[model samples]
Target: MPWKELRPMSQKLEFVEKAIVPGANVSALCRDFGISRQTAHKWLRRYRDQGYLGLVEKSRRPASSPLATAEDVVVSIIELRSKHASWGPQKIAGVLARRLGPEAPSPTTVARVLRRLGKVKRRRPAARIWSVDGRPRIEVKASNDLWTIDFKGWWRALNGDKCEPLTVRDAFSRRVLAVALVPATTAAHVRRVLELLFRKHGLPSAIQSDNGSPFICSRSRGGLTVLSAWLVSLGIRIVRSRPGHPQDNGGHERMHRDLSELQLSPARSRRAQQRQCDRWMLDFNHVRPHDALGGKTPAELYRNSTRRSLSPLLPTYPPEWLTRRANKAGYVRINGDQVFVATALARQLIGLRQESELRWSARFFDVDLGMIEILPIDHAYLGGTVMETVTTVRPSERARERIPVSA
Candidate 1:
C-alpha cells in the first residue's frame, strides 16, 4: 500500500517524463503507476520546479521555538525563591501555573533558568545517619492490616503522676482510634483500650507495638506479655519493632510526635489533656487533610472492614470450657479457687484448643486469649482446630491462695 513498494527510479522517471514534461497528461501517467492523479501531479510539479534534484530525499523534521520567560514573571519567581528557597519545583509550579497564569514557564524550565543563573542554592545533602535497612519500609494500602500502638514516651506533669499517653492509629488511614491518659500503661490498661477499639471498629488483622514491658515483655518466658497473648487469641497477628528501634513503628511514632507537638504540649491538667486530645482526634480524623491520604481525612479512607463484630458480651460456647466466672477483681473463679490468665481474657470461660503436633491454646468465647504460652501449645499463637470438650481442671491450691479472698 505504500508508494515505496513500487520500483523507485522507474516510477519516478515515469512520472517525471510522462506527467512532468511539457506535453504530458497527468491522468494517463497516474493510471500507469497505479497512483492517484493528485499524487502524480504533486510529483510532477516538484520535478518541474527543481528538475532531478527535487526527486532526492530531505529531512522531515520540525523546528524548535524557544519559549521566552517574561522579564516580569522571571523577576517574581526570583523574588519568591529569594524569600523561601526551600520551596521546591512542584510548589512553585502550583503557585505560578495554577494560581498565577498560563504565561509562566513550566516548573522544569523555570528550574533550568534559575540553575543557569546560579540562583538555586547548592545544598550539601543532609548527612544520612546510618540505620538498620533490613526493616523494609512499606505503606499499608488499607486499614487494619496494621495498627501502630505505642505510649507517647512518658513525661512528668506538673503534678508528677507521670502521664503516659497511649495511642493507636490505623497504619493506612492514620485514623487516631484511642488517646488516653492512664496512671500507668500496664498490660491491663492496654488490653482495655484494645477492647474498646475491637468493640467499636472491629478487630484489625494485626497490631504493631514496641517491644517494651506492656506491649512486649522480654522477661516473659514466651517473649510476649498477657496483652500480646490476648491479641493472638483473637486471631490478630502481632508485630513488634526491633529492640530499641523507634523507626520500626514509624507511623505511630510520627503520630506521637505530632500529637505531642500540636495537641499535648498545650494542656496543663490531666482532665484538660484528655478533653483537648478528644477534640484534636475529632479534627484529625474528619477535618485535617492527611498528606498520606492526599489531604483527605483518615476517616475518608478507613471503613468497617471486619468479617464479624464482637458481640455485646463475649459469646458463650457449649459447656466444653471449664466454667470460671470472672470476679470483680478480674480473676477467674474456679472451684472456689482463682488463676488470673490475663486481664484482657478476664470474665470469660476459656477452652484449651488442640493444634498440630499435640499443641494447645486457651480461648475465651470465640476470641483467642493473648497471654504467654501455656505449655503444650504457645499461647501467643493459637494454631488449632476448634474442639468441643469441657475443661475439667480445677485451680491448684496455690493458685487459689493467690486469688484475693473477697466478700
Candidate 2:
C-alpha cells in the first residue's frame, strides 16, 4: 500500500493539538510527527503565544543582505540603460566604471541586476561558423591602414523623404570617421564627402568597399569606377568585398545593426535625421564601449593618418617607365595609334613598359591596364601607298591582382 502525503500545515496543527492536551508527552508527539525536539518546541511555543495561526510555515529569508547592490547604483545603471537601450551589460558596466570609479559593479553583476529587473532579454547563441573566400583580407595594424566605406540601405523618414547615410570607418580602431547623408549615390557626391574626410582625417593606405555603383563598375576592367580611379590616383589601394557577402565586412555590418536597433523610429525630416545620426555617431565614437576593443570607445584608439591630402593628385612612376596622360575621350596614344583605356581613367596618367618587341604593358599607377599590341596594317584601300598603324588592347589577366604595398 502507498503512503498518503500529508500537508505540512495540517501535520503541524495535528501535532500541536496533540501536545496541547493536559499530560500529553511532547517528545512522543515530536517522534510521531517525524520532527526534531527543537522544532516541536518551537511550534508549541508559537501555538501557545498565537493560537492556530502560528502553526503555518514562516519565511526563512534574512531581513537584509549586506552585499546587495545599492539603490543609487542600481538607479544609475537603469538610467544609463534607459538612455542607451541598445547597449549590453559590458558596455553599461564600462560606463558605470567611468562614472562610479571603484564602486562600479562588474559586468556579471550588472547582467544579474538587469536580468532581475526584467531589462535584459535572453538571446539565442549565434552559430560560430567560419566562412572562407580565397581572397585575403587587408591587415590593419594602425589607425589609417585600412578604411571601410559603405552606404546604409535607404529608409523612408516620417515625412516620407528618403534617407541614405554614407558611413566611413577605420578598420583597426573601429572608429567611425564620417556619417554623411548624401543627396545621391553618384561618384561625385561620394567623392565630395571623401574629399572632406581626406582633408580632415588624412589619407588611409587602403579603402575597402563593396562592388556597387559609385564604388565599382562590374562591366569595367578591374571593376574600377570613377571614385575608385580617383582613389587610385591618390595612391590609395582599393579593397573590394565579395559580391553578396556582407560578412566579409562583419564589423561594419555589426555597427549598422547597432544603428538600426537604436534608431528604430524615423525622424521628421532629412535634416532632423542627420542630426539624429550625428548624435548617434558622437555617442558611438565617444561613449559606447566595444567588446572587441577591450571595452574602450573607438575615439580613444583612433588617430588621424600621417598622409596628408595634397593637390595635384598624381602617381609617381619609376624613372625607367614611360608615362602618358589619357585624353578626355579615354584614349592614350601608343606609338602612332590611339588605344582606348577606361572612361573612368580619362585624364589620368598611364604608365607603359615594353614587354616584348610588339607587345607593351600599360598600367594606371599600380593597376595593370592590359597588353598594348602594336600591329602593322597594310591599307589596300589606298593602294598600299600609306601604312596604317593599328593598336590592339586586351584586358590584363593580372589586372585584378593584389595591390602593391607602395600603391
Candidate 3:
C-alpha cells in the first residue's frame, strides 16, 4: 500500500522516512504519494540537510528586512516621548527631523514605534461639532490682527494668596503677550494688565474674549462690559464668544490649559508664581514648538503691531462734540438728568454731540454711546419746568426719537 498522503506534514515525514531507507526508489515514492519528482526531491533535500524538523513548515518571511525602521531612530522617538510626554508623534517626528536631519523616521513610523512601546493611548475621539451656524468666525490674517484674552479660573497659591491669571495671547501667532497674576478679575485690574500689554505689543485690530466679568455685562447694552467699552473707545472692536461656549475661544483655552499645567509645582507666594509665569511665558513664546505654527515658536511668527500704543488717556474728539468727564459715578448729567456711561470711562473724558436741540449723541473716542433724547417734562408738577428724563436707547433707533447707547 502507498504511504498515507492525507496530511502534508505527515506525508513529508513519511515520504522522507521511507525514501531515506537504503535501496528505496525516490521516483516510486513520489508517484505513490501524489507528489511530483521535484517536490519529492525538495523535501528529501531539506530532510537530509536539517533532518525531520526541517520537513515541518518553514517561515516565509525574508531573512533580512532593509525597509524596517532603524533601531536608533526608534530609540530617538522613545527619547523624545520621554522628554515631552504630551507631544504626539507628529511633533516628535518634527523635532527629531530638525535635530537628526532628513533621515529621521516619518510621523507614521514614529506612531507605530510608540504603539509597539506601549506609549500610544487609544482614545475614542469626541464627536466633532461642525456647525458654526451662529458663531462668529474671525479669520486671523496677521500677528496683531486679533488678540484673545481670558482669565484662567483663579487658584490659591501655597501662601494662601488668590491668583487669578489674566492671559493675553496673540490669536494669529499664539504669542502670550502677558500672563499677569492679578488679585482679582475686576475690570480695573484687568484693564491695567491690558494697558501694559497694549503698550508693549501695540494695539490689535480686535480683542476677542469670553462673556465674563470685565469682558461682558448682562445688564449692559450689547453685553459690553467696562473693559470692552474701553477697547471700543480705542477703535479696537470687541468680540465676545457666545455664552457657555468655551470652544469659541478654543485656542486661548488651550493656552490656559498649558499655563495650568505649568503650575505643577505650586509657588508659595504671588511673587514666586509671577516669576514662574514669566519664565513659562518666555518658554512658550520662544522655546516650545507650536504644531499649528508648523513647529515654529510663537515668537518666530509674531510681530509688533504697526498701530502705536496710545497714552491710555481718553482719545480726542472733534471740536463739534462736547467733552465731559465720566464722573466717579459713571454718569454724565445731561439737561439736569443723570445718564449712565460705563464705569470703565469713570473720570475719563467722553464726548457728547448735540445732533439737535432736543437730541444729543454721546461718544467715547470714536465709538458712539447712543443718543440722549430730552424727554418731555411733567407740566403738572413744577410750573412747566423741562427737566428732561431719559431711558436707555438702542443703536437701531436712529430716527425713532431715541439714541443708540453703548452698554
Candidate 4:
C-alpha cells in the first residue's frame, strides 16, 4: 500500500490498538491496513512508551543529548554505528552495556552517546521502513535446518550478459551451498542446481524463497511449483517470504549484496565472473569468519554429524505409485500420461503418484520429480525444441564414456 493511502500515524495506532482487543480480528485488520502483526505491535510499543504522544507524528531525529561524555566513548559508538547503520539503540546498547558495565546508563544514554558523536543520523523514514533488521537475531540449530534460496536480482556484466545468481544458503551455517550464474533463471535450470545440492548436501529441513514464478508461490496454485513440490515430497517444508516483503528473506538478500560488493564486479567478463564466484564460494564456506557465529566459518557449521557423506545414489520411490521405465528414446507412459524425458534419463524409472483426478504426481530417485510437465497424455515430448532435447544427451554419453567402461 502507498503511504498516501494509509491514514496518519495517530489514526493507524488508534485503529490497531482498538483492533488488537480480544476477538477483534487482528489478521483481518492487518490485511485491510496492508501491515503485519509485527508492524502493528511496533506502533503499539511506541504507544505504551509515550502514550498518545507516541502515536503523534515525530521526527526521526533525536530530541535529547547526553552531558559531558568522554570523546573516545562517543567516537567508538560512532565507528560501530557507522559500520552497522541499521542497528538500533537496543543493539548498540547491548554492545556498550557489556563494555561499560556498572557505569552504563540507559538505552537513551547510549543513543545520546551515539548522537553526541554524530554517528547516529536522524533515522530516515524511508530507510527505517525499508532497511531490514539484519542483526542475526535468530540462531540456527544444527546443519541444514533451513536453506534460504533465491535468484539474485539481476546485474549487468562487462560482457553485456545479465547475471542472475542462483544462491542456496544454509540458515544454520550461513554457508552458501551454490552460487550459480546464468543468463536467465528458469525452473529447469534451478531444478538442475537443486538436484546437485540434494545429491551432495543430503537435504535441508525446509527451504525459503520468494513468490516469483521460478520460486512458485501463488494462491491459485497454493505456491506449488516444481521445485517446492519436489522439496515437499522429500518431507521438506517450504516457507515463502511474505508478499511484497523482501526483507522477510534478509539473509539471502544480504548475500547477494555481499557478492556484488566483494566478489563479482560490473567490469568482470563472464569467465572472470565465474572464477570470482567460485573463489568467493570457497572462501565464504571455508575461510570468512561470521561475526554472528563468533568468528566461525560456514563450512564448520554446515557439516551434519548425523550423515557424513551424502548417499551415493538417489533412493527409489515407494511401490504404490505406478512406475514406468524411460525407454532409450527417453519417453515414459504412465496412467496414460506420456512424459518426454531427456534421452540421458533413459533406463531410469519415473514414478507417478496416481491420484483420483487428472493430476499426476511424479517422482525420481529419492527426490520427488517436480517438473513432470509431460506434453500430453500421449504426445511424445515438447521441450523448447526437438534439437535442444537431442543435443543434451550427447554430453551425458560423453560423461559416461569418460568413466571406466567396465570394472
lDDT of 1 at 112: 76
TM-score head-to-head 1 vs 3, winner: 3
Q: Which one wins by lDDT: 1 or 2?
A: 2
The C-alpha TM-scores of every prediction are 0.44, 0.60, 0.54, 0.42
Poorest 10 consecutive residues by lDDT, candidate 4: 398-407
> In candidate 1, what are the lDDT values of residues 1-407, reduced to their tens digit?
24577677667776677664677777776776778877676677778789877876657764654676677878877877888888876677677886567776688977876887888788854421212225634456678878888888766555554566889898878899988887777878888887878878888877887677687664332344567756765667667677778877777877887777543364566776678778878988999898767878988999866645544344455555454555444455444334455454445445544342223345555444432122221123223432112222222211111222332
Least accurate 10 contiguous residues by lDDT in model 2: 398-407
What TM value does model 2 have?
0.60
Superposed model 3: Cα runs more than 4 Å off: 1-134, 221-226, 312-328, 332-338, 347-371, 379-388, 395-407
Number of the predicted model whose TM-score against the real structure is largest: 2
- Model 1 has a clash total of 9
What tens-digit string does per-residue lDDT give for candidate 4 at 230-254? 5555657667676678788887888
lDDT (10s digit) by residue, model 3, range 265-311: 77898888899899999999999998899999999999998787564
For residue 191, model 1's alpha carbon misses the true position, in angstroms, by 1.3
Q: Rank the candidates by lDDT, best first.
A: 2, 3, 1, 4
For every candidate in turn, the CA RMSD to the true structure comes to: 23.6, 26.9, 25.9, 25.4
**Local accuracy by lDDT, each model:** 0.64, 0.80, 0.78, 0.64
